[model samples]
Target chain A: MSEVQRVENRELQPERAANQAAEQGWRDRAIVPPVDIFEQDDAVTILADMPGVTPESLGVEVKDHTLSIEGEIAVQMPEGVSARYADLRGSRYARYFTLGDEIDTDGIEGTIHHGVLNVRLPKRDTHRKRRIEIQAT
Target chain B: MFRDLWRANDPLFGDLGRLLRMMDSNWDNVGSADLRSAPRGSFPLLNVGETDEAYNVYVFAPGVEEQDIEISVQDNVLMLSGKRADPADDEKAAGRNWYRRERFSGEFNRAITLPDGVDADRVKASLKNGVLTISLHKRAEIQPRRIDIQAA
Candidate 1:
């Protein structure tokens, strides 16, 4: 039960007038999708559950030691279909993580399959441990 | 450890746990038409709807393949079961440390009681982009029909 701090931009909710006025235009509310993060010896992997997001609608970016992920879900209904018991609806998914210096940002790779986003951040060469040899005189 | 903080005399941490529980309850009560009566905290939340001729059930199950999912209708009860493979099982994920694990893995099952007059034999299911949609057609006798207006 390791606890990881979750940072959410609560003020970004569209319903808040004060927050909305500061933004450029109307923006969809973004929900933070649940994620599982694993730190291997050579790399760190992140798997986020972002259902409804297709590969074309998924975006992952890393800038200024920060990693950000965004996914947009397109909701479509048949012509004759109508919602009777509606609960989960299409929405935006957004999340951010602070990357450490040991991470090799250039080697980072990401993919989305079955609406899940998988990100792998490799460790820099200098960050890997190396054994020092002792000279016998 | 969090247990130590929970037992501490400080009220700040005490209030934090209480607030988290409150938020969970609030989320559970947000929706209006939850007819299944399923217990709270079920993974892969679902949405059920109906049209003139059929009922639509959508299961929000990301990262699951069609082969991993099973859907069946028996005795007017619709059952959905699926497995979300654990990412840690990947060879590249060996010898890793976990900082956070919020996404649910493993198998999950959910059952929903369907309304009468549904044609179980006509049910169809499809998985697209991780969303499993099941359409249960209604019987011909139960489908809504408009009566022709007679000229007066």
Candidate 2:
């Protein structure tokens, strides 16, 4: 199996980047959430595991043959409750995938449930395989 | 002879390097990055903490539903079990090319030993944004009490 390619986002404004770095501490960095890609006859499905992210906090954008997914993790702490032990803290999750022209970008659909994001990219009709029948001579 | 010796050592060095990288990756995933002690299980990463009134446990399990999860406390041990469904069979049968597959899917179970003061009967669990937050209320006798200072 081919290794998953990791891409880093480089479009963040310097000021905002600095502010985010400061807010999340130096050790906390944007993590690439694990994903599974499945191909069907007519569409490709992508599932991403992003814990602590709500539907409202997820952003999916496709531009210039690139599909980008970003999820913001909001750790809401009830008032007066402090952590005595912690493992999974809040952090941003981001990933990107390059799409081929055969994909019908306009027909793309995405849904988020239980912190899992599923994206379906339908193939263009022209790109789908068609069975040609042989004429009896 | 020297070239032959070097070639013989090449795999040994390569194996050592690979082993180191494996250890590093495991540490990154199972060690301090988790912000807790070493992981007890492999599937869902967990965080456990305690407050004055309750013990808090957070399970990071995405793509799972409350109905799919099972939680029970027995003998001061909290057991969690659930299954993460895989993609539809039709998709798999279509023979799609996979560039990468990292997400874990299948049955998983984790057992955590509760702290001494936890009140099993009062434990409450809720699923939000794919994270399971379990609150184990502390026993009334074990909860901290503020002592009143009398002015003499």
Candidate 3:
């Protein structure tokens, strides 16, 4: 009986917690778009899925050493057209982060194709860890 | 009548339509250069297919469940819509420094126009393992047939 009660409590706890979190607007529930990140040896690559967001509808800004990506995708139906189904809506896409001292923002590059965005951030060669050799005197 | 059914039965599709409308209504607000400048457009890749009978498009939308997909066809036009809800939206929203964002959150919608004679009524759609598959049937009038050549 105790075990069952404990399990029940565990299940209810999440709901209660979720309710509380919802009130704060800080729940893991996303009200924003989606994004993916990858790390490379000398740089990091970011890929975000922004369907309907054409190359002309996005914006990236950097300030105070912090990078922010913002944009909007506006899809136009064909002439004399009406939609029967759709999955995307127009909304703001945004993300921001502070860069570490080791990063070289000057070398950063990005590209957008078919609604997919890619950004490359390279790290400074001096900041990269390397092995040193020593010879006996 | 149809709109009512759609709204009650398929909120995802409804949301997709909303997105399309928003984009269309705000065309002047969008710019290719601006969109390219942002990180929101980044994605790995997508898959598409076309056959004599119909065209099939599949998107790798991980974390998207079957019920999340919404597909519809009207007047030989097909639309595919779905959302990969943000994993970090509901709880623990703050205090997490987002070093980078590549996954799409909120809502997503995709639309394609079908060729003449594509059977919108017989169209079928399915979702499996985060992949959304849409099959547009070809109308009988459009299907290629071997007509017998009559001798003059």
Each model's iRMS: 13.3, 14.6, 11.1
Q: To one decimal place, how large is model 3's interface RMSD in Å?
A: 11.1
Candidate ranking (DockQ, best to worst): 1, 2, 3
In model 2 chain B, the worst 10-residue window by lDDT is: B1-10
TM-score, cand. 3: 0.42
lDDT of 3 by residue, A8-123 (tens): 99999997676555433421222255667656557766666554455577776667888777666454322332323323322446677677887788888777655556677788
- Candidate 1 Cα misplacement greater than 4 A, ranges: A1-27, A131-137, B1-36
Please write out the lDDT profile of model 1 over residues B24-121, one tens digit for every residue. 46754565534655544467777666778888888889888888888989867788888988877867566789988999999998877767888989
TM-score of 1: 0.73
Listed per model in order, the count of residue pairs whose N, CA or C atoms clash below 3 Å is 0, 0, 44
Worst 10 residues of 2 chain A by lDDT: A1-10
Candidate 3 positional error at A102, Å: 1.6
Q: Which order, best to worst by TM-score? A: 1, 2, 3
User: Which sections of candidate 2 miss by over 4 Å?
Assistant: A1-28, A84-89, A132-137, B1-41, B88-97
> What tens digits encode model 2's per-residue C-alpha lDDT throughout B1-152?
11111221222223333343345356445423322223433668776666678877788899888899999987566789999886644444456767568987889887766657678899899999898988888889989899999999
What DockQ class does candidate 1 belong to?
Answer: acceptable
TM-score of each: 0.73, 0.72, 0.42
Task: Tell me, per candidate, how large a share of the native contacts it keeps.
Answer: 0.64, 0.59, 0.11
Root mean square deviation (Cα) for candidate 2: 13.6
Candidate 3 residue lDDT tens string, B80-99: 56666663573734333455
Which candidate has the highest lDDT of all?
Answer: 1
Q: Is 1 or 2 the stronger prediction by DockQ? A: 1
